[model samples]
Target: MFTRFSPYWLWGLLSIFPIFWTYLVLASSNPSIVHILVHPSGEWAARLLIFTLMITPLSMFFKNSALVRWMRRNRRYFGVASFAYAAMHTVFYVADKGSLAQVLDELPRLYILTGWLAFAIFVPLAATSVDFAVRKMGRHWKALQRWVYVSAVLTLVHWASLNDWNSPLGAVVHFTPLVVLEGYRIRHHFAMRMKRTA
Candidate 1:
């Protein structure tokens, strides 16, 4: 079944289509719908980041090395899409607020501050994503790339802390997969260390 199609591009396209579709649906709705669209679009980007992050862990745990190959090949696309949605989110927010002055007014607010930090964190990660940039940055590349994890956590924080922490539905829905993926990576890393010592 996997042989019939190109895994990376084909699957990635399938994964991302719903995001654009949702954006269109939201755009066609109420004038105040931009916030709704941006939030979920940003969430989808986080989810894709999880999907990209999960590929290696899944491949390792299941002993399917090809999955890692396919995922790594498309990892850049995931990062790129994450940036794209984030950009859309910023645009929506700016448009929704009407002007720079209005946006500046919201800047001191917690929701705006949290989201601003998350998007600010993503900008550099996206910029340094290419092969040439990575090679040039050397060890700094890995350090800078860890910003994705920060962005992911900040994304959830931005959403969860918006109204109240008691609203666990949104956090649970998004954070669960991230927790699982991180757990798997922890186990995989420990196992590798154990093997080296053995």
Candidate 2:
């Protein structure tokens, strides 16, 4: 019964995010909503991306089979949410600029280009997210999805370079959990390598 309803639970949880954030954006004042739309949308994407990355290491650490299963199952949902918010962020950017051409003109800027590159990586990852794609692509699908790590790095760069960390935005602080998790992963890799060498 739990298995049957887990997807429903996931859908409901996911639905809350879009509905709440969209409502906040819509209710916000006009001039402030410009920043409101872009920031919340982009930050949510980053947060979800980090959570997706954490599923593997976190599941490994906890040693809880049910937790592991849930994380693995919901990972794709988190990934899709990440991409959706990224799309919204891009839309907000273009909308704020008031013209597609105006936004295009800024593509040459380093920060803008970095964000674009991250979004580009998201496209294929989101496209091939289905189970059929997994079966069809087999080994290659995993390789393609590894690009997600590259996107994460690019996203961090874009956020850091574009926003102030010490300000109310707390941009850099938002990635704290991800940094800690990744640090744990790095240490574990070295520990394994040392054991192998011994």
Candidate 3:
């Protein structure tokens, strides 16, 4: 199946998914589009970011070379998709506020500020994700991309502080697995460094 379809097609298909959902949500008479988009897009972004981080550890844990290869080949798509959904979520937020100026005014609030900072980190990461940027930066590219983990943590903080129980509970549910996977990766990397030094 992978041999038959091009990655460009995958990109286009994934790109259309959110737009289609947005249209349907707006067409409904119940909840507003802004309401529908905010939660779904944010959750989608969270899930994609989680999957992007999982690719390496899951493959290694299962001793699956095919999983590793496939995930490595497509990791960029997942990263980009996560950013897209995040942007979509933010756009709906601004729209719900009636104007960009209102959103800016609210930026003084902690939740809004945290969310802005999270996206600020994502901006440079997304900009430098291309092949050209990778080549141009060489070794530093890996260091720069490491910021994704930071952004993910900031995103969770932003969510956890947003309200009462529901948001924090959601954060715990979504964040626990990511924390565990990253912990494993850190331990493995440290052991490898120790072995090399010894």
Candidate 4:
């Protein structure tokens, strides 16, 4: 059955798997569903965003790997899916808060503030993730997408600042590989430039 559909279709299906799973969990009507889903949904959003960002450095390092090339082509799918999961996370958070006033009360907290800022950045990036926007924005599209780096930093802070900075291992572990690969990418580029100039 999987053989009949193209890889793009398969990837698209994979991208939405978390949403499907969340729906299944919600349908079960667990009383704590909002609380249960909140962390995982945010984690999925972060993971997908990491995957989306990893493509460029991985492609640079791999150079000729078909899998990396495929990931590069489908990077936007991961990005948009990241936004979807993030929206879900935000919804679940609001539901858990039970009132707008309660939610607003926590907005002054560092973690909450950073998370909202990251989500704010994601809004425009996700909105323009279409072919039409790509064509219309042309060179500017990439510049706008660069804001994802800022979002990533805010996400890291948001995750780390939870519980008064008592627990940050999960967020640190998840982001470590992306940081390493990006560092390598920068170093490699600098070395190449030096070689060219020499």
Score every model by TM-score. Answer: 0.79, 0.84, 0.88, 0.90
- Write candidate 3's Cα lDDT for 81-186 as tens digits: 8898898888878777887788888888776787888888988998988999999999999999999988888788777778633458887888898789879988
Tens digits of lDDT, candidate 4, 6-110: 667856776675667567666967788778778888998899898889899999878878777777777898898889889989988998899999999999999
lDDT per residue for candidate 1 within 131-159, as digits (tens), equals 99999999999998888888877777777
Best by TM-score: 4
Q: What lDDT score belongs to each candidate, Candidate 1 first?
A: 0.74, 0.82, 0.82, 0.89
Number of clashes recorded per candidate: 0, 0, 0, 0
lDDT of 2 by residue, 8-38 (tens): 7777786786777677768876676766678
Model 2: ten consecutive residues of lowest lDDT: 163-172
lDDT of 4 at 66: 75
**Model 1 error, position 102 (Å):** 2.5
Give the candidates in order of lDDT, highest first.
Answer: 4, 2, 3, 1
Sum up the clashes in candidate 1.
0
Ten-residue region with minimum lDDT total, candidate 3: 158-167
Q: Which segments of model 3 are wrong by more than 4 Å?
A: 1-5, 25-31
